[model samples]
Target: MWRTIGGMLGTDLCPNNIWQYFSWCYSFLPDGEIFYTFGLAALCWAAWNCRNRTTFEFKKMRSPFDVIYVACGFITYWAGLLMGEDREAMERGAKMLRGNAANMMRICAAPGGVN
Candidate 1:
């Protein structure tokens, strides 16, 4: 199931030479190819989980909580990607996404270390 969805997504989002995208964009990751593979796999799993849960029909009024949750998820995923493989960067990115920009930037841009 995960493979099927991953294949479809790869085909749509990254056709021939998909590794190129990861290698070029995510140089921070030791193995961009593997990271992308796992990321897509996780996405497939989440999609399946959502499918198994109750489905929402023509939503009248969108829930703010749901919107916020989805936005957080999006932010987390993108920030994690952008932060590369640096533990400090990743942590800072997470904090930033959680509305701690001041602290995140402070820690992220720290000269010696991250605290």
Candidate 2:
């Protein structure tokens, strides 16, 4: 997933280093930074919600796919509410991130992944 995102954004990010991620996004994706921020925020919120549901409601833990699905929905809905010339670019970036997330989920579900 990180590889796919880095490829799309034209950066080589360190998976364990969030500072590097932020710097890379801020530098390379200046135009689409808001979308990236929103997407990450949504992902965090979704993960928190999923954690809460699992803890309090005794619900099963959500898969990576479910979390990314929620993030994509949030990004799309939020992007739709923005008004600017860069809105299209934002949407495109969000969609690309969403697609990458889906692809990562597929890879994670494959034979050598965390079955």
Candidate 3:
């Protein structure tokens, strides 16, 4: 999923471990720590939901990018919790996240698309 995120962000996240992933995200995003924190929170929440649904309801997502889409929704809603520029920043980030995920989803759905 994190690799999917890097793809959305137009980077190759070839992190050897979770620590490297965290460090890279913390430094690479526009707002660095804040953006990394916000994105990670939403992604984790979405992952948790997916896990529960898969484990209890026996449902499966057709693609891993589904988590990214769900994370966008979560962050969009959570963005309201911020104030001033933080809220605006989060909204923008959410928009980008959602748009990127949507594009990826479409591409993956098309014939002979990138997987």
Candidate 4:
């Protein structure tokens, strides 16, 4: 499952390598960055719902695809509510982070500093 998603994203999507997954997302999802962010936010919401269902209702775990489908629905609903300026702001932030990512990585990777 992860291997296929990773292949499509051009990076590893394993739990231990989330930084790599995010890096790939930042670099590759230029046009779709806002949409991707929305999708991920919706996914988090969906996961929380699933968690509550499991803990409180004792429901069986949902399939991964089902979770994703619900997230997509949330994204669609949220996208309808998001203003154009909100999306533009998100795009600007993504571009600014992309522009400075190399410098930030260098600073974090340097010796005698926090890793």
Candidate 5:
């Protein structure tokens, strides 16, 4: 997937189209897209959904951690589809993300830390 065959005679030479870039980058990765890369996708999806909720549903984001928490939930749930070390790794990563977000939330909640 990184390189096309010498069969490309009519196409302009390119590093990769923006659309294919992410696919090529994630393809055949040892870490697998399902864990880390998909986590990014999950986070983005969570943010988009959260934005929609706030805008259309009139929901309020009381803290920035709300997005992170939602993302962690998504990734953690999807990790169940994996097995062995991949699953473990994804869980650990999700746990770390949750922990860090919580700490940041706590700091923001503290006096003079955020507001």
Candidate 6:
């Protein structure tokens, strides 16, 4: 059975149960991350290709601190989840990353902006 195969994978990273399905849907839903990564890349590309001083000034540039924070937080949290004993803790960790990532993206994309 699929459950048996999942158990054999020896780690709970795949959300093997129904509870995990709900958790992943609410938490690790990959769409947001995809959008964030692409959006950042696009912004950087547009900035580099533009001749506008205001858009291209390094001194006036926003630091990537918020993005870094969210990235590090996601890595740390997910790594911790991999070491966790049960689905609940993993779910909680995933939710934390999702929330942090969302907040971080908002900060990065705020109009008139953030640094």
Best candidate, TM-score: 3
CA deviation > 4 Å runs, candidate 3:
14-16, 110-115
TM-score of 6: 0.26
Candidate 2 lDDT tens digits, 1-115: 3565676666666455667767777777776666656756776777787778888999885465666666666767777778786667657766887777777767777577455
Lowest-scoring 10 consecutive residues by lDDT in candidate 3?
26-35
**Model 4 over residues 7-102: C-alpha lDDT tens digits?**
434555543455665665677666665565564577678778877888899998645444544554565567556678765554454344333433
Name the regions of candidate 6 deviating beyond 4 angstroms: 1-85, 112-115
Residue by residue across 14-100, what tens digits does model 1's lDDT show?
A: 323556646532653454343455444444444444444435543432322233233335435654555446534444433433443
Off by over 4 Å in 2: 1-12, 15-19, 112-115
RMSD of each: 13.9, 3.9, 3.4, 14.6, 11.3, 16.6
| Candidate ranking (lDDT, best to worst) | 3, 2, 5, 4, 6, 1
> What's the true lDDT of residue 29 in model 2?
71
Write down the TM-score for model 1. 0.29
- Report lDDT (CA) for all predictions: 0.40, 0.68, 0.78, 0.55, 0.64, 0.41
Give the distance in Å from residue 108's predicted Cα in candidate 4 to where it truly belongs: 40
Tens digits of per-residue lDDT for model 6, 1-115: 2221123223335555556644544454443432333323433443443325345563442434333334334444444434434434444444554455455556657586456
Among these predictions, the greatest lDDT belongs to: 3
Residue 64 miss distance in model 3 (angstroms)? 1.9
TM-score of each: 0.29, 0.68, 0.80, 0.53, 0.66, 0.26
Ranking by TM-score: 3, 2, 5, 4, 1, 6
TM-score of 2: 0.68
For TM-score, candidate 1 versus 5, the one ahead is: 5
Stretches of candidate 4 off by over 4 Å are 1-18, 83-115
Clashes of each: 0, 0, 0, 0, 0, 0
Clashes in predicted model 3: 0
